[model samples]
Target chain A: MQVPAPFDYKRASTLAEAIALLRECGPDSRVIAGGHSLLPMMKLRLARPEVLIDINHLSELDYIKVDGNTLKIGAMVRHVTLQKSHLAAEYYPIFAEAEEQIADPLVRNRGTVGGSLCQADPAEDLSAVFSALKADILIAGSYGTRKLPISEFHTGPYTTALNPDEILTEIDVPLRSNTGSAYEKVERRVGDWAIAAVGTMVRVDDGLISEAGIGLTAVRADHFRAKEAEDSLLGRSPSTEAIAEAASLAARHCNPFADQRGPEDYKRHLVEELAKRALSRALNRSLPEVH
Target chain B: MRVNMSVNGVEVSDEIEPRLLLVHFLRENLRLTGTHWGCDTSNCGTCTVLMDGMPVKSCTVLAAMASGSQITTVEGLGANGELDPVQQGFIEMHGLQCGFCTSGMMLSARWLLDHNPNPSEKEIREAISGQICRCTGYENIVRSIKWAAAHSQNSGVQQGVEA
Candidate 1:
């Protein structure tokens, strides 16, 4: 019984054509890649764009490759591709681990990585995974291309730093040699959104943790991360006490809202517990002896 | 807008609205009601179909996006009036009680067996996790997929298109 409001549709053969369509259609327009996230919202009357520019044919933007030291992932890369990228898994196991837990196989087959990131749903798994990896986003506009750190990409839930004429073309994940990342999530059912989840990347040298990145989702973590917690981990030994302190700090700062998922206290507890588990797994991955 | 796509291996062209969902286009426009409509939110896989040989929820995809793609619906599962191994497996394993989720489940199983000739019970379960059988018929569904996986080699008429 649900359907989108009547709108004009244009399929963009190239990125330039897509940008021009966006500009010509004005701000009332939206470009759809996979349309998994956008279409559902369109049906609910939550998003009412006057024009829809389809960018599915832009194959130039669908790729996963290594460019120097960064693993460059195209915006048009589908979720299934991201999940199966052995190159990405070699660099960051978090990519495959998180992709497996996002939605379902059918949904993932059509959902593009760019569409998921652009949708900017607070509970989306990849956003947290990207935040944990400190990935950079590339945006293209009529003027030219500009780069923004993924930290500054999401302005708020369901919103981003993208202008009307801008399109996210690629994501740059800096590959590290001695680093490991993992994601831990707890959902009520199969393919459901996380009630509370944590993604962390740890770079350990000798016995000291050189860098730590902790990203939380659904618990309302600021910028989808626990900066205070990550800061506490700087140059600290990968000891149980150090990890527990960071985990506790991560759980303390997050402000979770209650819904059918659970109460706030339960989510906060999950943040702390899941953070501890993910951090432990990442730390172990970084150190082969204990792994 | 006018859309042209191969449906069940048939070349079909139709004039349709841009907002039309693939599920509606298949059912109302093409009269391919074998692809059911359930939980329009796209969470339920009742409207699942193969796009370029991969399973996708048709409700979430715009018909415009499927213009150049090859779509295989439930009606296309069998070849030359013979049931696909998946369909036969469904019957052999008693996969359906209410049969509401059968079409989508069978299509997903067909896709799985096409890519992976033999899938374990866990893999079969994962392939159809997006679908919901209100009848709670998962046990039989898993058995049905395993049957298809076992029978896939013997019965090779190919899937999707006859061509």
Candidate 2:
């Protein structure tokens, strides 16, 4: 039977209490929000935290709203909530697209944004979606709060910039007018992780590409962001040639390892194709008449 | 650790290890074995239960984390010893071949019908996409959920749901 090692579980009523508990419990302690990712890791003996501080009761952190031009999502917001939030869909449909492909509905009901980000799995879809949206993450630690760009949040696979005494509190996506975003993933099954997926955001100004962001996942894309492909799309007309060229750049740059999903060449091909489709959809959505 | 939670409308308390999963707690501690335990890794939905009225894989949830929460297992689907429409649908439509995945499938169907009284075949399929059924190939399972939707709409929603 898969079971976690013995540990003490503490439910914190307040964020301060949670942080204090984390500091007191030491590095062997973990702050668990949804626990979907952590618990499974624990069961496999891959993660052996001696203390778990449950933050599910910190309802104060479970919110998604627009604070001015920024779309702010609380870290504790459940995946199902994120998938259903019209506010998030209004700004970027990528949230729904990515959330739909995260896992089964049952798993999504218990998974949280903070937990997903902190887990930092390379095949995780939200990281690519948020990377494409150019979002910022707010992390609260014993010292104070720190706002880090999503691009810099993941230091490596299964790792983040969060400290042991810190908890990610919120994710902020900058709302841009004349911009549209989409996420495209091709998983082996309905709920499996992506073999290679691409998320794209494009701002069309006067029939020209004003801003472009491309995020790739499950293909060893560094920081899950394709800066070269994004840069290639800027200031250019959203044309077939331009998009294909950018897609080729994204495919060429990513380093995908072979696995049961497919060979490296096939994954790279998916990266190029998915990137093209996502960019086209994003460009189409950016046009008011097209939408 | 001592945990208190409502299981099937009854307040229950149990002394459990913090690492004890909710599935194990329900099966061993509470002896509600109707909720099947499969794929201890959380990949299989056989360990699903209603946590605060939403379907969650209990295998991945710690019993200690369920303190003060309301959990409804497969045994709670019926009322007054009457079979739920979901269960009836399964019987009438032959939704199960082996019945190993029946309880979790029924609970997910119940939750789906609760939220959407008349879900399309596509919607029903999407709702239970997380669950694995080695038998039935899901064709009859989809029809079974549709049957539940029809039955509920005809007889009206029984057992007022909170949610």
Candidate 3:
């Protein structure tokens, strides 16, 4: 019989109306998109906002499209939509793969991208996926819109750089040619949070690694990324030895705490193994096939 | 606040508190107990209902958010006193032992059949992955969904039970 503490609820029919309500409600107010993450927190008394601005009616913020070299995704886009989007699969298969592993279908139907990123749970899969993709997020406020790289969005666990009055409206992912990405997670069960997950993106140029991004989640990796691993793979051929060394670097850089999931050493070991597998798969996908 | 929505093709309105969850609203206010409430968290699918023709965990959704939206519960599955193919399949294939997870499972199966008429066993399992049946009756549940897919067109006609 869990119920949220008493609070005033207001539904905003438009984005402008929502921003107006946010400005009026002040910092004690919070915007709820899907209510999957926020409501559960409210039930536990972890989050007790005085006012909840429901933004589900702002359907204008729900879309997935490719413009120029960027794949722009609306904040209101649900997890199920991303998992089923052919455009997302073609450009970055990591999104679809990670979406499939984020909760189950019932939760996916209502869980929005904005809500997930805003929640900023350390174990959330999309944060790692977007971090690996080096995406940018658009935050809309009363004044105007501002864009911030996903790496700079999160300041701490369950915290984002978003101001109380600002609403995240869109996620922008840059599309790269001859690049491949993959997400690997080790969850205790189907819908459980990851013990340690790794998302890797690799771009090969002329048989050398031009760029690489390795993002880790649930392991307390700084900035939710493995910069040491990324630097180790740059300007080098993604050979077996290079990949193994880079995976070890990712494992060495993480700081996982022991909990019900497993001990710290075990999670760090998973970070190493999963990072290696993701890097290997990404490299395989990036390289052209030889007949 | 006043929330108005369509439940099972019927328009309904209620003056519910903003904190009222859609699950409690359905059971307490509207007396639609067919939508079971289990595991207040979104882990269990027993509280699942169709919101705009897609299955969503009702426990996590506020009734206020459902305003002007269409919701379909197990009570709305069959029409004219006839069972939906999913309902009949459950009965014939013994998809339930305790029957606590029946409504959610049947509704999810119905959604899957509507979208994909010929889903394999793996697909059926994946479709209902969110649902939890403590009775461990998943084998028959899979078979029940298959039965509905096999007899989707003429669910009214009873077919001979296979030996």
Best by lDDT: 3
- Poorest 10 consecutive residues by lDDT, candidate 1 chain A: A282-291
Name the regions of candidate 3 deviating beyond 4 angstroms.
B154-163
Q: List residue ranges in candidate 2 displaced over 4 A.
A: B153-163
**DockQ for every prediction shown:** 0.83, 0.82, 0.83
Interface RMSD of each: 0.7, 0.8, 0.6
Clash count for candidate 2 is: 0
Error of 1 at B13 (Å): 0.4
Error of 1 at A277 (Å): 0.7
Clashing pairs in 2: none
Q: Which portions of model 1 miss their true places by more than 4 Å?
A: B154-163
TM-score of each model, paired residue for residue: 0.97, 0.97, 0.97
DockQ of 1: 0.83
